[model samples]
Target: MKSLNKVLLGSATLLAAITLAACGKSSSDSTTSDSKTVSGTVKLWVDTTKVPYYKTIVKDFNKEYPDVKVTVTQSPNGSANAKTDVGKDPSKAADVFEVANDQLGSMANQGYINPLSPAATKAVKKNNVAVASEAVTWDGKMYGYPTSQQAQTLYYNKAKLSADDVKTWAGLTAKGVVATDFTNAYNFYPVFLSAGTYLYGKNGETLKGTDANTAAGVAAMTWFAQQKSNKGVMQTSNALNQLKSGNAAATLDGPWDSANIKKILGDDFAVAPYPTINVGGKDVQMQAFLGVGCFAVNSNTATKNQKAAATLAQYVTNKKSQLVVYKHSGAIPVDKAAQASSTVASDPVAKAVITMSQEGYSTIMPKMTQMATFWNLSAPLINGAYTGSIPAAQYQAKLDTFVSAISKAN
Candidate 1:
């Protein structure tokens, strides 16, 4: 349950290509005089899975600000581009929108959103991870308020492996555990991070490649391939079946899987960070794949509407609302104060994600424009090397081809 049930390279494709599919989740608020009635048609767009929980938070907010009557609406799942399309016109615009980190570049480039003022930016800066803020910033201006954040970590069944036993990928395999639908490209993320290899060069946002294709990267990829591909020790045909049927016991993933995992395993579930990798003769830390979801105000909203939207966004992202949102959605709260709450801080999985988010060098998932071009071939090529379909020496050439394909497409 802690592992994702499905792997959508397609979503990753959208992310890398700089095109977003839109979902129609909507929220509303109204203005008033007596008691400061907060009534207006506030528009919102979010995934369906989050709509119900979002409604609860909106309801609670309405209770506190009764004068502001609010409405909530659900969006079709996996349609981020459609949401962006509506944002083009005020008639169909959402007062506030939820854009995934991967799609931020496109959304920002289209000028559909407004940047946060210095005051609001400072507020978010005080509590949020610097990377989270940076992910939503473009051209040195902040445009979004992060609502939730996450990074990769290990989740295991306590009944199956001791935390100490589940610390490393090798250990997890020893316990007869494996990843759920993880491609070699995805699985190697931890090792690359631990090795301090990033997909793009951090200097001036240049993406010319890095040591991620190095011997260390290949070694790590080969190790995982041996477990899942060669040794037959790890389950290859969907790791979730292994978890659901008790065939597998440990896996790596993020908070997105928490709620379902809780339902499947109950209290037997345990969480830990990725096992350390060797770097420079030292035990390096786990590399986490970090991403975030944020709220942005429309650039076209009137100054009055913009101010009100900003206020509403801040209120919803505040500690109490974050608690409600995280509890219901299984999302990592963006507020530092919320991270300290017993409910969040006590969870080992949440803790591991936070630990990684804090120390981990967060990177942008490729903007949508490059996804399919890079990943469609990248995953296959990387998997081929690990599975012995391609020679190890050819790794750099294969990677170069994929990168060239995607870069040219972009």
Candidate 2:
């Protein structure tokens, strides 16, 4: 089993963020962490499906800081749409809310969220996965309290294909059908990374550092076009349905849907890190975009309640609460201790997620504000290539256009 807890902290970027956060601690915090006498009425927004379990977690939090009253409610839109929901009106948003790491940069810049207090940031860095800390950091400040790490892995039916067959794309397809969606940029855009190119550069902060317009980018686009004719690959909007019906022997998915798949595949259920695929005549590990889910404190919270709000954010993401979340929702915990617990370490699903979250198998989704623009452009480009609507001759031109648009001032 691949363990998420044992990550090397060697990145200069992550170090710089940690240093700047520590230095910022000398100044007065935007929010205080005085839990003892802190008092406030703070609201927390979580995904609708998560409200119940989170409410139970809130019970645990209130025991520590009874003076703070917290109301756990469902977000009007889910955490996936947090940026949009919060953007509609920041003042009206929850005092503490859930958000994906990719949105942290834009939210921090737009003043929708406050940087985590130094004490909170320090605890986060010390307690979570190295990449989890890095995920919430933007402009050298920690913007959120990370809760879970995510990456898609290959889920297969062991009855139809052996474990060895699923390790290589060619072998899986040759033996049984694999269903997936090319329309999801989330599903296929990592082909560019697998093909050997950077999405916002090595550190993912440089705008022009994106080189999807280069030869490597063209190669990735070409691979997408080639898949349209691959007999073994089935393109479907609902890959899960295909797998459920036995039309597809395998599908790529994350931990969120594990329960449903387990129910469907029963004893035959199996999962593993993505298989190797031949791109540009060389077999390379297929990659997925890794993501971290975090809870951010609103910058718009009442000044009197700042400490209370910060306390709530910190409480729900602590190691014990993270394990609770993992048990109830299958959100793979980013907490180092939680990941190392027997419950997580021995779980097959967690092992696959931890393996895929590593250097060669995945890329952490970049936390650039311009990511909004990249998402708008990436999906259509990938879909067009897969459907051959963009044509083979225009692969370079299409990629060039995409890189140029996203590289502009953010």
Candidate 3:
């Protein structure tokens, strides 16, 4: 994956150079004219589920750039596949598209997406949540306009767990109704992350092995094993459904579960940042992996269409459009103004997710391709620890093996 990424980067750099030279004009000059005189059809790709929100955004965008016709299409492959889909055929790529922040590195490295214009960068910094802004930035360059923030939060039944009761793992364990997917590394990662275990170093520029055998990692795994024995942790295929059926008082999950869970729990539904966990008699706050949803311009877009595409991207991510998205999809908006609005302010789930993204000790999901190997290597370790196949006493040895595997993979 690392070698392939380097080849993609080299090819993309050359393509960008050729495209720039062929235009025979500075980006600044093209941007100025493209912003006003440029009038052409611009294509946008969005998740099938989000097509309505994008349609609404396009309607509003057209009012401003009436001459720039915008067509919205659903990306059958989903946002994560945007880079490969675009790279396969630049002419077929949408002028602007929505993608998860982790895809930014691949898209930018492959030149599937364009770097943000100065104005777009400024808007991203000024209006977005800090982590959301940071997620879209690749190698010190901003690539996308952030739209929403994603992270796991503690969703609880207010009837069973009080606001304070959900604040700590020990407290929840005593209540004995909290459940989370113990087998999946993504869902259980907060344990190691909050304990200071990391999957990579140098801001994802390097794939350093984790410290899962350290005191922190062992403590986290021990706590998790205890939960499994007590039935407070679940490895079921239907964790969310179980939570919705009132099988558990609380569950750790991302905002994607909000709509369905909210329908089931209704007024009893509530969310809070991941609680502090007791590890070796010390309290450590659990941290979540953070992600951002954003829109990026296609590098293949015609010079006359770049500014229009950027304009539409900005318009959709702005406070007004984000509010519309929140209303339609229940996604936590990244725009500060939108987040501060009464609708999101009053939504406990939205507030909790935003807080986790900002105040919690959350780690941004690394964009490096090496992350693929980390996920594959970490899953068995997490599962083995949870099922007691890898006992606490043996955690150090297993961790050493895991690290060795990662090094070999690298």
Candidate 4:
């Protein structure tokens, strides 16, 4: 982790420099590093388990800007439910809340959060991983400060399978069993990406431009069907337990589970990027949806508190706070400096996730308003194909229907 004072200094400097109006301007009043002028009451929503650590971070935040009083509370639901919870009534939601990257587009479109000012955006871009900056941007504006990354990578037992063996799907399945769930779209939808199809188009912003209804899409579905017959591939909802019981040699998982995985595999634990799979007769790299967790300032926050809320959002997502989140929650840090620190660089799980976050390894999850519909429809579509219920002949038709349904305006 970087020095706390340095990170705080950066946060203080950015806070001092920002003069732009936030999403809602109730008053002509402005906030700066001047503790008295910036004083306001703001609420922060975080995961229940994170309340304690975050409160500690807020304590340090107050030392720099004492007049800004922060109330840290557990969100009504976890971060995964951020969109729905905030949507229920944005004005009632916390002033600053935690959210995942995928929900940003709809939230931004619906006017639930404020976009970062250009100065804040420039600061964020200069400090975090390149992918982190990319993940928080929806359309042309950045709506949140990225704090951590969430990408599923290959977690294996080195004693059972060599690193090279895990490099290709065929190589992995032939040597040992892999426990995974085809019902999970997050785990397998990127198979379409590997097959050379785009989700919401190349830049991932075009609402009607998702291109997954072609021969490439069918090839990806067919590859799923083949996995059903592969003895080395085990369909399981609980992969960690399978790995612990020796029923599977590896599984696809995100950093959230790295701590538990380490305890289960102990001396044999190893991690790697996704393997190349045989799709359309050629080996192509398997990709995962790259998710970045972030902190967003609500557009509905009281106008007088807008600056404080924005500052709090930036403060808690800085490198020091990010490291705290990583230490206490196992979220892979998105800060470039934090990542290069020995604590993170030395961790195999973090290294693999960071590598997987790069281009060609994963795709930034599209943040379209229609993405909610995508999640609801895609898992069943993917599962039906994987389980042979959708059938090989209907692969194209099913994909066509799936794409059309999610492409419609909300």
lDDT for each candidate structure:
0.57, 0.81, 0.70, 0.83
lDDT string for model 2 (1-410, tens) is 01111110000111111111111224344534332666788899998888999999889777766778999999887787788898898788898898888888888778777676566677778888788888888888888888888898999999999999999999999999999988888888999999999988887878888998888888888888888888879999888899999999999888888888999899999999999988888899999888888888777777677767777777788888888888988889888878899999999999999999888999988988787788789989999999989997898888888999999986
Error of 1 at 408 (Å): 4.3
> For residue 151, what is the lDDT in candidate 1?
71
Per-residue lDDT tens digits for candidate 1, residues 125-225, read 88765666776666566666777776767777889888777665556666656555445455544455565555645521344644456656555445434
Question: Candidate 2 — which pairs collide?
Answer: none
User: Lowest-scoring 10 consecutive residues by lDDT in candidate 3?
Assistant: 8-17
| TM-score head-to-head 1 vs 2, winner | 2
Evaluate model 3: give its lDDT.
0.70
After superposition of all CA atoms, the RMSD between model 2 and the true structure is 5.6
Q: Identify the superior model by TM-score, candidate 1 or candidate 3.
A: 3
Query: Could you tell me the lDDT of residue 315 within candidate 4?
Result: 86
The best candidate in terms of lDDT: 4
Question: Candidate 2 — which residues are off by over 4 angstroms?
Answer: 1-28, 31-35
Where in model 3 is the C-alpha error above 4 Å? 1-35, 404-410
The CA root-mean-square deviation of candidate 3, after full C-alpha superposition on the true structure, stands at 6.0
Give lDDT tens digits, candidate 4, residues 18-38. Answer: 332545523222224433356
What TM-score does each of the candidates earn?
0.79, 0.91, 0.87, 0.93
Error of 1 at 25 (Å): 24
